[model samples]
Target: MSNPDTSSGTLPSHEIIVIPPSGHQDRLLLLDQCIHVRIDVFVHEQQFSLDVEVDEHDPIATHFLLRLVPSLTPIGTIRAYRAEGEKYYKLSRLAVLKPYRKYHFGRDLVLALHRWVNEDAIRSGLQVARVVCHSQLPVKGFYAKYGYQPEGDEFDEDGAPHQKMVAYPS
Candidate 1:
């Protein structure tokens, strides 16, 4: 069952739930909300190119959202896509509203995604869950705290520094 707080309606102040993509309508809604919040933070606010942020893979990927109570406003989102020719999932596009940053919503979003991916993998008989975040120098440690390891030297994405990282279930 989907969390009532995050279902298709208004919620109260103390609750928020993550929803899974099940059908076309649900998937489209999740994509729009996720893209909106991510672009607002990564593109418009941070000056990252919009082209780099919105990608063709979004339409088919699994998406999730966190919403505010009473207002049903979207507060955060995360997504994962299957890497071609591989048995792993690539988690990406994690974002949360600026006002909610200090409350660990970002980490919560990640943990939620981790749960979703792990369950899906076990159900499908898959072996690993992998994620790559733009190695923002400061946040590399953050990802490390969650078990992601840097795979290579830093690279640039829309003029911002980044590095590839991966996570595996223990």
Candidate 2:
């Protein structure tokens, strides 16, 4: 589905602003907005514990945030990072506000991460590489829409069932 502004009708390019990973302190401050959305969706809405919400990977991971145009309200977030001595990035913490989910905000966030992964691959002197995520069982189809396939057995993550989904970024 095409993204539509809150008021209805097609959203213009300017209706959305995506903040990509850049500097150090600036990114950290902006990441606070992303963490807010994650807490709302993962901890509060989904009843996950706060302890599992944030982890050590956060500091080094590249983050992205999507905000409303004029209001600058953060509505979605995702992160990408390669594991220690690993080549592929692990996409994680993808979330979109409940009311904004109908606008395909999650799709936009994932695509933005993919673009970042592609760029990172080029910077590392490669064409593209594998990307993976521990996708919640319920959103398996959603991840599949972006070429991710379940590659392993289901397991528990933060008390919820999850599957290891893999994809190749391009």
Candidate 3:
């Protein structure tokens, strides 16, 4: 069944805030919110070990946090970083709470990240060729809906099956 939060046919008042790396004290607080969501969905729910869930890329990645309006509680998050010396950006750690999954928050998060990439690329006069993800095999189709194509055979990541997928901007 779809979440009641969305089944009513009325869009929920929510926002995806982009947390670009900057010199701000509150940046850690914002990142804590992103970490909380990831811990809930990735570590607790999915059983990924904490060591594997938190990685070196986190410090360099651009993070996104989704907050429901009124209460403004953080409920979803995702992050992306550019692949070294390459025209590719890698998206990772996308998660939405169980109740919020039906709201299409995950899809919105990806789209928002893509939008940010396009704008940043234009502003910096850099050509970004693609966005890539090491998606869990089960949800590869979710990324496909956004035009990502599988790049290689499935491989084990943190004891779970994952596959490389890439999406070129249209």
Candidate 4:
């Protein structure tokens, strides 16, 4: 899918690239930005337990970063990791900077991940792709709109109520 209009209402000179986990040095820098945003938002702002925010899995997980042109500053990030013994991909730690949230960057980041997963599945000859999301209870409907279904009862994570949800793409 095409990216949403993030051009400040005027044409933008910068281009947005989605870097996979295996990308090179520059890509690793972008991934770091994504992790930083998540830590800032979920760990600091929301007071989520610090332990819930960082983990050893990060180094091996797939990450996505949204970089602006010219300055090339990363403004948003999302991550995906293998789940259920590599049978599914769990998407987590999605965050966009406060100033850039108005541009629909979060949605764009998600769509980019979805596209990447689809492409990966095709190349690997897989029939379907799976993504799991841990969503705040009230916002579960937002994910539902994207075809995610609750997997089980609500659970508490980092002191906040969340529901486990899964999406299957054929």
Local accuracy of candidate 4 as per-residue lDDT tens digits, 1-170? 12445656653333446654565767676666777778767876677887768787787777787777776776678877775357677878878766566566777777777887778777766667888889888768767867789988999887889999998755
The whole-model C-alpha lDDT of candidate 3 against the native structure comes to 0.86
Model 4 TM-score? 0.80
Over 36-70, each residue of candidate 3 has an lDDT whose tens digit, in order, gives 88998999899999998889888888999998887
Off by over 4 Å in 1: 1-22
lDDT of 3 at 65: 95
Q: Which ten residues in a row are the worst by lDDT in model 2? A: 11-20
Q: Write one digit per residue (lDDT tens) for candidate 1, span 1-170.
A: 12233343332353345554556456667567778999888887788888788887676677778876666778788877776666877878888776566566777778877887888788878866655555676678877878889998888877878888888754
lDDT comparing candidate 1 with the true structure:
0.73
Winner on TM-score between 1 and 2 is 2
The lDDT-based order of candidates, best leading, equals 3, 2, 4, 1
TM-score of each: 0.82, 0.88, 0.91, 0.80
Residue pairs with backbone atoms closer than 3 Å in model 2 (clashes): none
For model 2, how does the per-residue alpha-carbon lDDT over 1-170 read when each residue is reduced to its tens digit?
23344666465332333444556457766789989989988998899999988998887888888887676777778988998889878999999877677668788888888988888888887656889999999899999999999997999988999999999966
- Taken over the whole model, the C-alpha lDDT of each candidate is 0.73, 0.82, 0.86, 0.73
